[model samples]
Target chain A: MTTRERTDVRRLPEKQVRDVAVLHAILDGALQAAVGFQVDGQPFVLPMACAREGDDLLLHGSTGSRLMRTLAAGAPVCVSVTHLDGLVYARSAFESSMRYRSATILGTAVLVPDDEKLHALEVLTEHLLPGRWAELRAPRAKELAATSVLRVALEEWSVKVSDGFPDDPDEDLDEPVWAGVVPMRVSYDDPVDAPDLAPDRPVPPHVRALLDRS
Target chain B: MTTRERTDVRRLPEKQVRDVAVLHAILDGALQAAVGFQVDGQPFVLPMACAREGDDLLLHGSTGSRLMRTLAAGAPVCVSVTHLDGLVYARSAFESSMRYRSATILGTAVLVPDDEKLHALEVLTEHLLPGRWAELRAPRAKELAATSVLRVALEEWSVKVSDGFPDDPDEDLDEPVWAGVVPMRVSYDDPVDAPDLAPDRPVPPHVRALLDRS
Candidate 1:
């Protein structure tokens, strides 16, 4: 069983969701996460492509990066992923807010062992760009050596969901204004071929599939 | 003149951009930022709506929140904003990456005085939901009291932009595979009217404009 610590929602306790499925949904849907770690009391947040494999989230970066090195050393870190669904418009500024699903995990990341490094990379590539892992050339030994894969177990995490419509006060609801949601989404456009593409090479079926799915 | 320290890019130095204008552009275009701050060695990253006013970036949160209180106390913080432009696919898994423009700022945040708190809130509202600030009712005294606005000067920061096409090695480039970028964007759909909206109240002109702009 998964146990959580100080992951409770203090500000908006009503919005805190404790279901594990909800946590997985947030993790699987997001393409990237903002990783938070500190160096000499100064915190740094970097954007990274994230992949959720079973109980742990996989994050990869250049082994030479200070943040990666710190994480490999088991420094405390926070992995946060947020999806902005829309802008909530209300009659009053106080009630106006955003509709988002955000999940934050607090833990130390352990570097994936050398024996499993290639498998971790496969998980990341498949998660970030589905079906491309099978099409692309696998990472060579040198490439794996240059990359650092950190996996943080999903032991302590919190998921907050704000998916409701604007909730303005009764008095404000009577105001002659439109108060609702402006839904937003991220979409993929047509893929552009590389400049030095070999002749007779067409966009791969997997790439074309992405457009269809989008 | 702005002085920067410890903002140098250590890994992949070619992607680092030191131009202040580029920093401003990244800050101005983003609707939200991931705020990183450490408390007792456990780091937390929260999603925050950001507004760039002059040389300072304003962030607001509940006054009762610990993160807000810590930041108000002038604790070191890192505010990062990233815009994902596209997904880069290469012939090899090692060469594949995402196209993104990310900016990270390191500094201490000061609480905006009570007198200036309202203006700071307005800046945040306008930046996040452009043109909606003027239409909504201004915050009441109680609401203003419950909110805490903090400003961090952009004196030390760095930006990393990855806009180039896939840079696969010669051997991989000749592989009979498609390698290019699939453009991505966040856009808004039609506004969904609230169920309890006043009868015959039309969507505001400002809200309607969002769809067109997107």
Candidate 2:
């Protein structure tokens, strides 16, 4: 999806903005994100396992979570996703930096309607477990009542990014220092089976497929 | 180093403040984070590639970035680090959720003094590239002058985390749905050598060692 077109005086310059494409990449690649907000002048950030549902982000919390209650009051919020691409080492300390992609969305969240909540949940499930949704049982009424689901539109956002090698001072370029980017990434390692699983139960096909891909 | 004493918050009872030890784990393990602040009246949250530098967080930007300039103005700022620990697949769609750990710090920043800037740079260097700082050239006067370094104390912060599997409704627990956590992590693959490097130049010991540790 495209980022918001509007610009503000405080916005990062075009070059920095262009780097924002990395932000989208981080969000699109992950299964979850951390959502931030200000409550009573105090800041609160919660890491919610999330899924991008269509043009909106679907987040679920316990029914009585303070974050959920705050959003229910229509408070403005910020959702951010970031992926650390690499560490840039320059000839000099001033030029050392990181290559990263991050996206921040600033907007108010609305509770998902009863009818749409199920779909959002499905999207979240698939995003996390891939094939588990079809195999799992659906939520009952009481369970639905105990959960709080939020849908935030991905408008009014900006992405800022930095990449490439360090930009050393001209004079120090010849300094006998090694310089380059050391990359980093998020990965899924071997899975640990649940302690309570039945002895004869084999790894499910979906889980096996995901592990194999990794 | 420990997270600030007053900045830790607990997830149980859902709102009490905890200790820094708990907060430290969240900050240390988060996969990504969004750094937020205001320039003039507009809000900006840039996802940061970060690592803890003692009790302070080391954030790097362009030599003359808007973010650095604004932060140098002494306005209050918020930095958040988050990791999506797992996806909580419950019996029902509404019960589906994610487990995560996140830390948020809110405070004013001080432009690190010139005398201490070098030390700050070392903290960042070691955090990002480990042993590369000794291998790289130090910053020259002009290069150091051109860069901005700001330090925000970890006071007035809070970390909220959730782990384990989804808490499905009692009635739905019997519903033949699969439930569990799909764990996540940050990993590194094989390193790619720079094309400009002399063909005979071997990978440095420090760089090569990161593969085993990172």
Candidate 3:
């Protein structure tokens, strides 16, 4: 079901994704998002760490931020998550492009209730760093007091998935250059321990696990 | 040299970068950028392939797009480029964050002139996938007519670099958990040939170079 007025795909209708699962996957796979809001006639976009909890996307910013305050008051915002998948090299300059999955949500956001602030923070922490939430110390009261958490319902959104090969026109196919997708993958390097760590402390199992998996 | 009003780094002042070289490097290294503009008080952020040509950042969109049309008329916009460097695991949830290099440029954008549209496209192609612009067929007249290229001057911008280890509070540092940065690197996989390629055609040297370098 698409919110036809707000979430309808206009430019590339073929790449539009309406499945709820696909939208969730793109959000879950990304560690960060670009959040945009306008002040007067100018728009400001900030790259922020984000997390999706069930149907609402959670984002945190300094309590003193004007943008955060504007968003907390239910201003319309757009949160966009993009995963760059590959580089598509076609036989023509016009056809060459990138492979990416991008989801854009357009809606007004409300501030998270004070009672759920800690839980929201936990959701954000766990979603971003997986197992680190349980191992790390809980947020202090002052820390929680200084942060603002906002949630935008996933009601009006559009997901565009472009994972296919380059679509060169029939005549351009024989242009005498190789054409294909060069897949881009992100690999995690070994963790570098903090310089201030105790001499006896070693890289923990959680950090080591990323090395093995990535 | 700092345009404090527009480019001030508000959240974490210490991480703010004012060097033009670092800003250029971040833009040069990125293949895409999230461009944000507002229409009727609602902000829209779209992912588009980007190229930095000297002091102007070039982005192309369909001529029929409302955003593109507004931008072509010199609407104020925010173009943000972010490179996610790693995940920072700290001793406390409050201290955990991501390491990234982010540059945000705030300015009005002008449409590239008709005469220079092709050159701008060439700049984008060469910056995105080097060594292939000379090998590919140039865009046809109809294709050029359908594309809209906009350039934003890099006059007022700020770069934020967060590359340091987790800065956990002193008391939390002994929390019995490993803390460090898990670096994320993007690498290219072996090229997947297009399905319709001629049997005798091979992956070109330009495409093979990415495999060797990445």
DockQ of each: 0.82, 0.38, 0.80
Tens digits of lDDT, candidate 3, A153-184: 99889999999998988988878888888999
| lDDT tens digits by residue: candidate 1, B1-214 | 1234468888778999988899999999887789999888888999887889999999878899878988988889999898888889888889889999899998999999999998999998988788888877778999999988889999889999999899988888788777889998888999998889889788888888888987
In model 2, state the lDDT of residue B176.
Answer: 53
Per-structure clash totals for the candidates: 0, 4, 0
Tell me the tens digit of each residue's lDDT in model 1 across A1-214: 1234468887888999989899999999887899999888888899888899998999989899888988999899999999999999888777888999999999999999999999999999988778888887768889988988899999899999999999887878787677899998888899988888888778888778888876
Q: Find the 10 residues in a row with the least total lDDT in model 1 chain B.
A: B1-10
Better of 1 and 2 by lDDT: 1
- Candidate with better lDDT, 2 vs 3: 3
Superposition error at A163 for model 3 (Å) = 0.9
TM-score of 1: 0.97
In terms of docking quality, model 2 is acceptable
Model 2 chain A is weakest, by summed lDDT over 10 consecutive residues, at A1-10
- State model 3's lDDT: 0.87
- Looking at model 1, residue A74 earns an lDDT score of 89
Which sections of candidate 3 miss by over 4 Å? Answer: A1-3, B1-3
lDDT of 3 at B21: 96
Quote the chain B TM-score of every prediction.
0.95, 0.85, 0.96
